[model samples]
Target: MSVEIVTARWIVTGAQDETTPVIHDDAALASRDGIVLAVGPAAEIKAAYPEATVTDYPHHLIMPGLVNSHHHIGLTPLQLGAPDYALELWFAARLSMRKLDPYLDTLYSAFEMISSGITTVQHIQGWATGDLDEVLGAARGVLGAYEAVGMRASYCYAVREQNRFVYEADEDFCARLPAEAGRVMAAHLARQKMSFADFMTLYDELKAGNRNPRARIQLAPANLHWMTDDGLLAIKEKSDAEGVPMHMHLLETAYQKEYARRRTGTTAVKHLEKLGLLGPQLTLGHGVWMTEEDIEICAGTGTCICHNCSSNFRLRSGVLPLMELQRRGMVVGMGIDEAGINDDRDMLQEMRMALTVHRGPGMDHSAVPTPTQVLRMASEHGALTTAFGAEIGRLDPGRRFDAVVLDYSSATWPYQDPDIAPLDALIHRAKTKDVHAVLVDGEVIYRDGQFTRINRESILAQIAEALAKPRDTSEQETHWLRAQVFGEVERFYDGYVPADTPRIPFQQGSSRV
Candidate 1:
């Protein structure tokens, strides 16, 4: 709209290093038409923007809005009836999840996401079984929900050329199964049948029709095991030609590491490097299994990473080398993945998880995570991974006016040391309930536990009613089929990794002497 001033007790500049960070106490920022105009002391900002409408919070901390850089589905797998399994088997187990309308499902998570101070997301959608048009419609449903909710999103329908289930090719894997089970499994995969040409075409079509100014489109190569050599090359060529970034899932699990070794005769990151696909325009979703050298390659090429901490733990995937990745100068971002530790999209918790999980049993403060580093991952670095680039990350002149106001008094509650570091307190003590308001593009979309653009209660009520029905016959049959074939998928990985193994992630040499 017009010039507006948002003042708070403290302002987190979203800029910091190991021990030093710039937090403005008794500060404010001025914005106009969705762009930040200036930021300085509260009195100076008020005087500078005299005619601007003022929204002042005397007991809140204003910080840049968070970015969930590697999100997938709207509803988490747990909510959709899938139990926690390792990353590989979890894919097969997810086949039985009852289908919900994509629009409502997206809104279900958007509510949680926004309430948790997430204003932007990197939504990498995939695994829809349908024709091109049908799949495009599903993409529309998801993008529409974000638009309706006023959440900025970088949307991509991940391009998966092969290995939809196990590490083997779909056809070859199904061919070895029992005749009856093979047929059912083949039939299940047949629904998702799409050609490589269709993947490129789908990206072009979506890009042309995307009407949301706040939203951007990108190409995702899905995962290393999922893409064939030619398909990976094609995706890289397209990304280079079109100047689009690619958010890919690679080396997420130990099984995936083994799969890469088999397929590429090297590590997954090395495989991408060989293919000439590692660069600034690519953001790897979960580099959990990436070796020390893999981290070096990524850092060398300016490759970004989205650390899905909760997802890795939830799926029993190995922990990411967050400390090493950050130390080697990689632009690592934070993501909740399917859900956070508490099974929701709270970024504060995700940041906390990142902060605490990386602390080794050592007294070296330099090796441990700093509050500013984690905050950067959740805000600035996370935004960098998405198509949003430098447009929506920081709270400063020239950046988009997207930020969260946290009730400092409520967050610190009955007692907090006045001399305590502001960033430390914000990261360690803040909760989703402490979010007083969220602004996107200079507009207050959510404030005082209410969404300004949409009705949260109505959406939640609708979702509850919509999912109240019992499973239909088709859903029941899918569940039975998954049960029948679960053992088959498990058997494929029986000896995937030997009883004795070495060279695990974040470590350089053999595990044993």
Candidate 2:
């Protein structure tokens, strides 16, 4: 590609710390060969890169593309008939969802993310079932979709050895179910059952086959409640040997915290620490129930956490105490764990929600989350959680020129002030519709309501055609019954906690007390 200079009315140099995002006015960004060359005064850039093509936006705000730190299959659980239930029960309801073509399903979400200023995503590929060949093919289809769209992605094959559905052993949980239900559950487990060695071999083969620079594979042991000790050890060994980062769901529910004590005689963080699994290479999906000590361990080990505010609220998983997490100086990132509030995967709305939801009780104005903090989490901090590692989040001189251009006129229309901070207004008020263009590696992949590389409308049409077929009626019946089984399992888990004791996330030590 030829050299080009993108000049905007204002440019947001994303937050490098807790402070406000730095903004440059009347500036231009120069790029060539898919990398940024400079970001400085437009006049200077014009004088230096006079031969470079210039794209001018007089009423636009340019910033680094959002990095979605954690995501599962693109389809929101609610969209597929799974209502708002606890995480475990919701998983059961999700089993009934008809599977779509992996490529289309992946693109379905990719379009939403790209349209909303997200350039990179950490896709936690958890639906690895069927035969080995089928699983490999599915993985390829998903990754291929990202490659097709020119978006960066970190793909992690979720591995779990035991406790596929509920916290108990598979056989024990099945014993409590009806005969027909037991058979269905057993068959499901049988399909999911694969030896750790075989899984590692498969991962090796898949990673070797998939050499896309934009997409990388990593490891994820589902969670402490699901994986056995051996499985955890395997993940650690592989992560260490291969030098690939690992991301996993951890203590997102109160029940999980209780289960940790019963199973390991300590907190989940402590157990992971004992196993030598806490480090910079590990990123926890949701640390909603993390205690003070857990936070300390995370800070000490340089571990990262991705806060999925929308999912936690939808599932009644309790607030993540994000203010506390950031105050502790731990690496934090933002994620629309299950799309967003509207199930449209709007990063702008996600940013607003993340900023508003974590306000603690006191009247201290500074205690509330700042727009800059949320922006950093969505951009720079988020890059840390993915395989990209600081390469795609910021719009630095040497970084990849991945950015989102928002029409400032539409974002702050009807009321625009010169003194008002543009970054603050953009984060608080911008919508996906305000996004004028999205660039990846110096190329405009999405511009003016269209994807430059693919026929998005045709892809949606194909998806509609695939879903027109009626699903299996028997599978629907099992979905309804499994809800009851999962409910019973949840009740059984309550036995681990004592009625006299109040299960709190952490103890607050007051100055007077």
TM-score of each: 0.97, 0.95
- Which regions of candidate 2 deviate over 4 angstroms? 473-487, 494-497, 503-513
Candidate 2: clashing pairs of residues = none
Models, CA RMSD each: 2.0, 2.5
TM-score of 1: 0.97
lDDT for each residue of candidate 1 in 102-187, tens digit (9 for 90 to 100):
88888888989999899999998987878999999999999999999999999999888777878888899888778887888888
- Against the hidden true structure, what lDDT does model 2 obtain? 0.85
Tens-place lDDT digits, model 2, residues 403-463: 9999989988899786778988888889889999999888899998899989899999998
- After superposing candidate 1 on the true structure, give the runs of residues whose Cα lies further than 4 Å from its correct spot: 504-513
Error of 1 at 86 (Å): 1.1
For each candidate, the alpha-carbon lDDT, in order, equals 0.87, 0.85
Scored by Cα lDDT, where does model 1 land? Answer: 0.87
Whose TM-score is greatest here?
Answer: 1
